[model samples]
Target chain A: MADAAISVQGARKVYSTPGKPKRTAVSNVSIQVESGTIHGLLGPNGAGKTTTLKMLLGLVRPTGGTFEVLGMDSTRPSGRRRVGFLPEQPYFPVNLTARQAMRFYGSLGGVDAARIPERTTALLARVGLADAERTELSKFSRGMLQRLGIAQALLGDPEVVILDEPASGLDPVGQRDVRNLMLELRDRGVTVLLSSHQLSEVEAVCDQVTILNRGSVAAEGDINALLNVDGRTSVRAMNMAELPPQVVSVAEEIAVSGGMWVFSMPTEQTRAVVDAIDEAGGTIAAITPKRESLDDYFAALLAAHTEDVAS
Target chain B: MMKRIWPIATAVMMDSLRRKVVYVVLGFAALLVLAIPSLPDYGLGVESAVFREVALALSYVTGLVVVLSLAANRVPAELEKRTVYNVLAKGVSRWEYLVGTWLGILGVMAGAIVAFTAIEMVVGYFTYGELMWRLWEGALATWFEMGVVSAFAVAVSSVTGPVVVVTAALAALFIGHSRSTLLGGEGAMALRPFYPSLDAFNVVNPVAHGSGVPLVYMLSMVVVFVGFAGACLSVGVLLLSRRDL
Candidate 1:
């Protein structure tokens, strides 16, 4: 059998509200995540990223099509046991200590009672909450609560971890810590499905990405492949005015900053620009190629999708 | 499956135990039941009469408290805190969750009922120089009545807001108390033409008769009320499971 961790085929969800026309949250969406890969689901607010995650977790029944997780039906208990989830906003019983919450979740996952305490302690320490083990959840800060959320999601060491906006309310250091954790999990050969509006975080940790727009998949592929702009090169020179007319005409756009001329070049002619600049005696200060970051790529995809919808 | 349900029930119990409303309501019920002895001297009635009235009133008050608190917090708290999403994502079916919560709330309500009954019994002992067996029977009937009311509140909470739930449950309680009259010969004869099942109203609407208390009678009543509660709770769980949370 193929080792795809998740396989969604033409899945769709429609929410019916009283006195209003039904709203389609996910529209005939199909995607797949292979085993041992970090997959990022990227979309703007209300673009069905969360909806898709919910469907994969079997929290919502799909109106059309089907999805499988870990080679079993998403709704089956055996399949769910191999998955862990972190919701966008997670809350715990106010009186439960961090350690108690872990043990509670662990027990629900059918961990042996004798092993739960030791495992809970180890998990709490791994999540950097060992010091706060005895603290009541009611007293936790937003960042602390998020850490607890992570701990609960990792309680059973699930094969597929799904997180929705895990870094939404974290500080820079907290975000970095979470990013490192995702990388660590990926290194351990766990499949990750994360949805986030923060493109930088996705770029830093995700191996593959799927961008959703207006309830449909707009783009999906390996992150590097999706973000690589093939025909783009950048050059910096001491002065653009001193360059030969032919060399300047070949430049797509040019600007002088910090006593250097920055040039954008078509990918096929970048070597020619370098040769022309060196020959023009315009002493090249720095030569670098510019590739689209995930943020830029997602923004452009969303803009194109919006334009398509509008037209 | 039972293992999964037990943790959910424990979580709900712990969550409800931490709410300040529970503490306040329970404290007030205890004080009210304790003050029954002093009411007779305040010209309310003779000592035994006062104890009976006070025990009945305490039962009604505690039942109302249970219905209001459980109904008010059931769905709203889950949605407000977003914890429902976490558990639901774990493949815990929504029906299982609702049933677990109902069991948890029922445990708390049972505790409250016991506490209030103990206070009333103590007062009865002090005022009459002996425990009233009738009062114990009344307490049993009150428990059944409260169970029915609690189930009704949970059903309302599945589909309506807290305010509406409390209102509808209280109205049901009052209507149930008049069920005896509603199922009487005159009532049945008048309504039988339109509704063939007019006689079945007594099954859903059980009214407690406090005149005499017997263990066998109260036990049978409890069985009947439990059946009603079970049906209502099943409907409640089904409705909640189908809802878009």
Candidate 2:
């Protein structure tokens, strides 16, 4: 925990209106992100993913919690000096050109005046906005603005970056760029806490994930640990006219297409299945542990939680 | 602290330059100042005094319109657009944000007032054939008063929209200048000193009809400006700190 780059413990946010019932936006949500790793925060709409990030960034006052970054309380300015945040659908002063906006945010991030222009140019080019440096933000497309948001968030070369829906308004290519950027940041030993709805993006880059449902952590921990199906092995074989009878008896899910057979069987049955395929003059193309897709895992987790609430 | 505050302030200043409100208001006020000498009731006996009075009034109105336009909308617009998220998330304290915003509006006001006053000085000089240096004194008072007004508007805007902020600011202005009229009774007079009034910034009598405001009085106006603006901004920071962006 001491080595964690970002730590949020028992975070809570309750909003009260004069004549309405108190609303809880977040409830006892805790997250620990280790240094130099990508941690994905996934949730459906209104699941408090953004709220948790806001609390961590001190943009929203938490009802109760201790948020820390690099062993300092994150709710204070000093603690956030080394952190960078990109809000969901990040907005900037539209009247400013891209270069001017970068200078403004860079200065706020405490970038040295002498280095700001150099850093701004480098960061803008890095985000694929070098050509638009002098273009006013009002003329920027949503995707361009998203890219600029990313550039500004990196102005200080932050040690820990918190991004909420960084790919919200991006195209497929831009989304790919963002995913690769996260990987690059992790490679540079920068910690990332990403709140996103793009499950594929998260699955591709995240080492760990926390799934929030209804303002609570419905599931968390290692991605593989949660998705890998225990005692099951997936097998793919080529040039098989049909699955061997012995293999078919044990294979739970079996399919054959274009002389390629794909099936899942108990891990203990792998040796027998291989032997049958070899005896049947079939090539063993690949054998790996069966795993659930993140999309499926997320849906099932939410469905079970809904059932729990309903019951 | 200045590092963070200065950037936000400069951003607001830069944004103000792009807005048309300042130019429109200043242009209209300049035209009015030019036309003041052509008033139907213009007389030869006290022409300079009358011109000074009307020019100062024009300056005040122009300053009010420009300040209200900027202060009322700056914070609310930023909040609505979520542009403030980037600033605050960069480790800027709420007080710094509010102060920087107010300071920027004040800076614009300073430029406008100086320009407008210089125009009045030129017009007054050509018409009366004497340098109406006293208009600078009026300009100083007007600028100080507008600074206070902008602080109030910026403070209110931290919690509400532009409409509420403008309405509240206008009401504060009326009450500020109407303290004696509103509090007429003996008992009310007892509470006069504690009342938040802006009369200390009013120097029309001295600058328009008599010798220019004394240096001591001008210094006192500075104190009043600082005190009122600081109090209002302190309240704004408190409100913004408690708010969830």
Candidate 3:
């Protein structure tokens, strides 16, 4: 099998709105996800995250470009067979029990009938629905429904799992459980592609992240490398009058509030600012380095894209 | 493809069977079929003629019920509930899904039709002291007619709302039944000069000629209507596959 679970190049999707020119949902967007990694497709609303996922799953045809999944063309049935998907809001037959729904989806995946019962039980237990296995899905809470959606997506042990906003409408505890389950799936060597507006969840779970804006990729790389908040440190002093001019110049922004100097510094000049403060005989009350989160990184990317579009 | 289609169709059948609507429709059909023996007392016609007339009317009513309850709701209900996305993403081809669903609902309607026909036959035998071949023939024609009408209902439900699809299908049924009479009229035939043009309209009408229930003609009409239904359904699947959902 290929090392990349999903690979897209120059993918584009255009929907022709009546009485208007065609609108592009994804434009020349390319993405590559390695096997056994949890990749996050992060973007603001209407940024084409769902469109990209739909194209990858062959749910919608692309206007341009090529993509492959699990060593087969994405448009082919063989490639789709290796994929398990959780739609943003999945529905089950109202009268069907959790067990029955799982069995139905599992059977569609061609799982052996003899093994379905065992697999269904295991999946229900995994999603913390063991007690409600026989309960009708219509009676399930929103959180329980989301968990069941995960359980169904895991049926037949698919090679790649795509979850679109898996944690949306979930409570804090439900979100945490889903995040843990995603990590567990990753650990077990399953490639996962997840899309979410929850930056904290993406930050905590994703190994690689791709930020999109206006139907195009704004930034793509390892989460840690892209979101590194180096050279920025917070400082506290008894008085602001003693701060030096050279230190002030190097500080990207310095705000004095609650008797503390918050310095956003240039990446290469943090050491110089600290030394200058010491040489000037200013006593540093506290110095704490700040780390940029996925939220901040995405915000910066989106802001840059807006500026680019405006110009 | 067949492997994937069979399971989906099985699921559809199982789900439809669990709906209370199916039982209500079946019970009403059976009651109408059983009530035929009492209709001769109205003095509208001979006893056997009245029995056959009432039996045929009962079949049409029950068939309409079957088409409405079992067929019209297949796709619209799924789409409304948002469950269509789950099955569509399972790598099942659109055509397979449509065909499987149609067959599943068809099976349920067929079962109901057979049960109602059997009840009417038993009631006839007990009341009239002889088997009525014409009534049996009418029942067979009704089954075929129902199959064709239900297929059209399914096709309509694929693309339109439940209310519109059912109403349009019922309208089509009325037109199809009266088509021969309309076309045979002197003024109507005179207005359409082109033979081929007239023939085209004739093709859309499913009714055929015979006194004691046109069995062969009814069978052929059902087959042709099913072919039309298949074409409509294929178009529906194509539209659905390209839809944003």
Candidate 4:
């Protein structure tokens, strides 16, 4: 569709050797990322997440698939001109200073020589590496290098950006910075495809997510749709020493923390609970659909997918 | 395509400058070039010729060392470190990457050979009070041969690791030069045309003791270099394209 910024269909990768069995890295895995949205790719180790990304970027040869970026075939050089990728644990030539490294990647990204310095300066500052611009990569810490990788990927103002574990080696603050950066990119109307093992980061920023399992897409949808607990509503109230008998009778799961009472119950009891709380002189702080944490949902989903394969 | 290739090549050249081996090879060769006049028992008139011979030999060995160190390890190291991912993921074609690598090795070799030749020229002037411009011809010839050797190293390195690539490249060099000895018999003479002989690049004979080869001959050497290097790089690109990485 016209709204799709990135599309991969039936992607399959099989590695073969002269004397060994052919190993399939991915199979029939398809993903469609809507334009200007943060699309998360999630999986545990060896789930073919990296392989599928590589196949789409032409870093790995695909046995079967069609990959497109911005309505062009992405498995070719020209298609990737408007795209950028930051690989996991990215490495650079250690001898180059950060500025020189940025210029090098900029040149490859088709940035003009006259504009490279200005763009490089801006990107380094954007990634929090303005002070490290003159430092050699050999002297860079892991987090510093990760920041530089991001700076380079942002060169040439690519329309579609792919970041694989962008915060892998970062501290908590750096991880938060990356999360903020992703949100900022989305606000700028850029399409980002983020592959990360850190589900918290994904849950914080991604609008849609695709979770891979054993080389196939195990789950894919909007974050709210996937994580929402159906037929349940969560409620929080303040100034309530004790719930009214009517509210207590309907409340299923209840907890009190920091002077606020929280409970989840069937969505059908919405009007009765609000009326009871109002009559009991309690303030209704919040009422919304209940949702499970991504961590819990991911574990349960993978366990079920694995059990199904085993059976 | 060439736009991307040039940047990768420039990066390779810049990175190679930071390695210690490049300086070590050039330094060792410079020392040998400086000591060429000190060989024992030389006739006064012919001593300069002997010096020229040793100087050209030094240039050949120096070029070979520099080329082997660079071409044998660059691709393998990039692969092992996954640095190639950044370059290729930027939409650089595999052929461009391979050609850019070989071209970078050639650029470094050119610099090394030029520095060595400059040292030889200065030593020649101080020792004999005459310019030995003939040595430039030998340097040119040796630089071209090294280009061919480096192409083979990069080609073989695409599919193999450094140690095996170095061994195979050295073997190819030996066979390249020993075509006559290996195919000397009347029965084998028919196959000489097909064997890739590097003897055409052996311009040291005329360059050191006499005037350098004719302009036409140097032009033919360029043809040979273009043919040999192009074929090797083509095979390298083909092999690397088939790889999963």
Number of the top DockQ candidate: 2
For model 4, the docking class works out as high
In what order do the candidates fall by lDDT, top score first? Answer: 2, 4, 3, 1
TM-score versus the correct structure, for each prediction: 0.85, 0.98, 0.83, 0.98
> Looking at model 3, how many pairs of residues clash?
0
Q: What is model 1's native contact fraction?
A: 0.49
> Interface Cα RMSD for candidate 1?
2.1
- Model 3 misplaced regions, further than 4 Å: A76-78, A230-290, B41-46, B131-137, B185-222
Every candidate's CA RMSD: 4.6, 1.2, 5.5, 1.3
What is the C-alpha local distance difference test score of each model?
0.75, 0.92, 0.76, 0.92
Q: Which has the greatest lDDT?
A: 2
Runs in model 1 deviating more than 4 A are A75-79, A231-290, B40-50, B185-219
In candidate 4, residue B69 scores what lDDT? 95
lDDT by residue (A36-97, candidate 3, tens digit) is: 99999989999999998888877778888787888788665557777889988777887899
Give lDDT tens digits, candidate 1, residues A1-311.
33889888898989987999999998978879989989999888888888887777766667787788887888544578778889987787768899888877787776788888887788778767889999998899888888889888987778899998899678898789889889999999899999888889999888888888888999998887887667777777875457667667778677777668886777777678778877877778776665687777877888999999999
The residue ranges of model 2 lying beyond 4 angstroms of the native Cα positions read none
lDDT of 3 at B169: 80
- Against the true structure, what is model 4's DockQ? 0.83
lDDT of 4 by residue, A1-311 (tens): 43999999999988888899988879779999999999999999999999999988888889998999999998887888888899999999998999999898999888998999999999999889999899999999999999999989899988999999999999999999999999999999899999999999999999999999999999999999999999999999999899999999999889999889999888999999999999999999999998999999999999999999999
In terms of docking quality, how is candidate 1 classified? acceptable
Candidate 1: TM-score, chain B only: 0.80
